[model samples]
Target: MAVESYKKIETYKASDVKTKVVDTDVLIIGGGMSGCGAAYEAAYWAKAANKKVVLVEKAAIERSGAVAHGLSAINCYLGLSGRSQFTNNKPITLEEFARYVTLDMMGVSREDLVVDYARNVDDSVHLFEKWGLPIWKDENGKYVREGRWQIMINGESYKPIVAEAAKKAIGEENIYERVFITHLLLDKDDKNKVAGAVGFSVRDPIFYVFKAKAVIIATGGATGLFRPKSTGEGMGRIWYAVFNTGSGYSMAIEAGAHTTQMEHRFIPTRFKDGYGPVGAWFLLFKSRATNAYGKDYTENVAAIEKYKPYANASPVPTPLRNHQMIEEIVQGRGPIYMRTEEALQKLSAGDPKNAKKLLEDAWEDFLDMTIDQALLWAATNTEPDKAPS
Candidate 1:
């Protein structure tokens, strides 16, 4: 059944490959935020049990996954310092957080999981601040708020700080960087149980077989699976991490793990071409996205009604907001723009003396997170006060 084109011109014997076996009490795949957090927590319990924890990363943990480049804000933080317009100016409670998540996800979210995350996310944020990540604070020393649940941060070194702590906790000897896990190894007697994993090094021809008592796959999302707008050389310029190819999902599915919502994917709107983050502009700066006619199309009741109750939800669901924008383009109001100049001018008007500082803050938003956006601005000689992004 094999095609002639699929045949290799040259082949090597199996003996030509090198294999190494590693045994650990817990095996963690991927080195993104989730993997690093898992390793940090697992190390404590692992050490107490006198067990070994091994983490394998396809790339270096210091600058890997979604947070590799950096971030301008901690998008999730439910602490006493947290303040949100959606929360009615009070600290967000566990129940409220869970409700918000459930609503935002269109009731597709697990309430128990959402509550658990809400309860502990603040501690992690505090830990990040304690670990030398500068969280922006107001004059009263309260953490600056950026929309609901988000806090401003000078996060150029966010991953490095988290990765350093995780490395220290897990120990340098246990980490296997540059090792890409190909698949999970199931127990021979019970095929449903995961016994270990198999991978190979990116640097060498050596193959790795890890025999873990338990395996944790935190390999982030399955980006690049769908066709991207940018093709060829610019193909890698996507909103999400390009390296995340759903290897974990594939491995788990192959081992008989059940899954749902496989067809559903979160599509976010970003700055045109550069794929720059629009969060800071929308949430922090309170910028409005308008159609080519300079109309705030999000206010279009007709479009919002199509998505029903989800569109009417507090803060409005991300998908619904994107839907309105897409509807605009489909309706011939193409080339939608974020009212950046209007937002900047309004913010500067409030603090006329600090206009220059405000401009720096706007630029820093892109610089700290998506450097490409800043580079794009530089290339185009963009002035935020003069034009929209």
Candidate 2:
């Protein structure tokens, strides 16, 4: 269902001139959430079997990927909020949470993995605790069981405590930083199973190769597409660990390992889109859309009423797009871009001010999503003053 969600524009850059390699038991790539998880799991598993493991990052620690703002509470939304009674509330398990999201977002159930995921989540939580991750606990001094999930944070830490633990697990000798792994080395004979990987030093300019029995890719999204101000090495324009592309996936694919969650990418959003991409994409995943007049647009309305069980719930940038296409002037917060005969009655009595604010919020999100100088361009292209980025 990725279905042309992103409009790809052609661009090019230079490639690696020199290359080299090394050998290891396990090589974990990327340092983002998934990458971190795999690194910890592999290292711990290997240690249990008395083996070796290594985690590689394109840049230094604390850069590249979602750690841009570090982590605090897990955003699982496990329990219902705004409920008055505390004890009456029930927490959600990992399986239930995954089921809800997967069903609502993808229309298919992740039934098989949910059980295993639920069984092991507690272990992952404690893994954070053992790594000096601070957890907010209950009066009894045990880890607090609230909402739907656990967290190891107060606010933002430049060094997410668990990240420090990951480094320790790998150690200076095993872990390589400031290295860029552009491609995963494969078994040339059968073209199956990972033989190792080939990346290099961004600073030293040499092939940093690793011949590993297994490789885990946790390196994150196609970053640097949008200019994000992340930590340390990422501060470089190429902060994307530009060198550490999708070698892990390619290598695995070459080795006959197929990927299931390939379609899972965060929806592009703009606050100005008002309903937010979640609502729109949810409707789309449900295979529905709306009318231009803003009515309850549905492709197959009759079919939806039959299913009642489900419910629901970045990034680099260039400028912004759309240029405030909503109704702005007569609508009050309407900005006139969204103006239409249908919206007028709602505008007359329906609090245009609030509506306008909503549109503005949506518009800001538009800028956030599109990164097109829409608002700024709006001022030059039209009469309205664009909001500052």
lDDT of each: 0.84, 0.49
Best candidate per TM-score, number?
A: 1
TM-score of candidate 1 on Cα atoms, chains taken together: 0.92
Please write out the lDDT profile of model 2 over residues 98-174, one tens digit for every residue: 65556544444455665556566656655666766555555656443323343323324524565666666666577
Task: Give residue 170's lDDT in candidate 1 (0 to 100).
Answer: 88
Counting clashing residue pairs in each candidate, in order, gives: 0, 40
What count of clashes does model 1 give? 0
lDDT of 1: 0.84
lDDT of 2: 0.49
Looking at candidate 1, the ten consecutive residues that score lowest on lDDT are 80-89
Q: Model 1, range 197-228, lDDT digits (tens) per residue?
A: 99998877789999989999889888876665
- Candidate 2: worst 10 consecutive residues by lDDT? 314-323
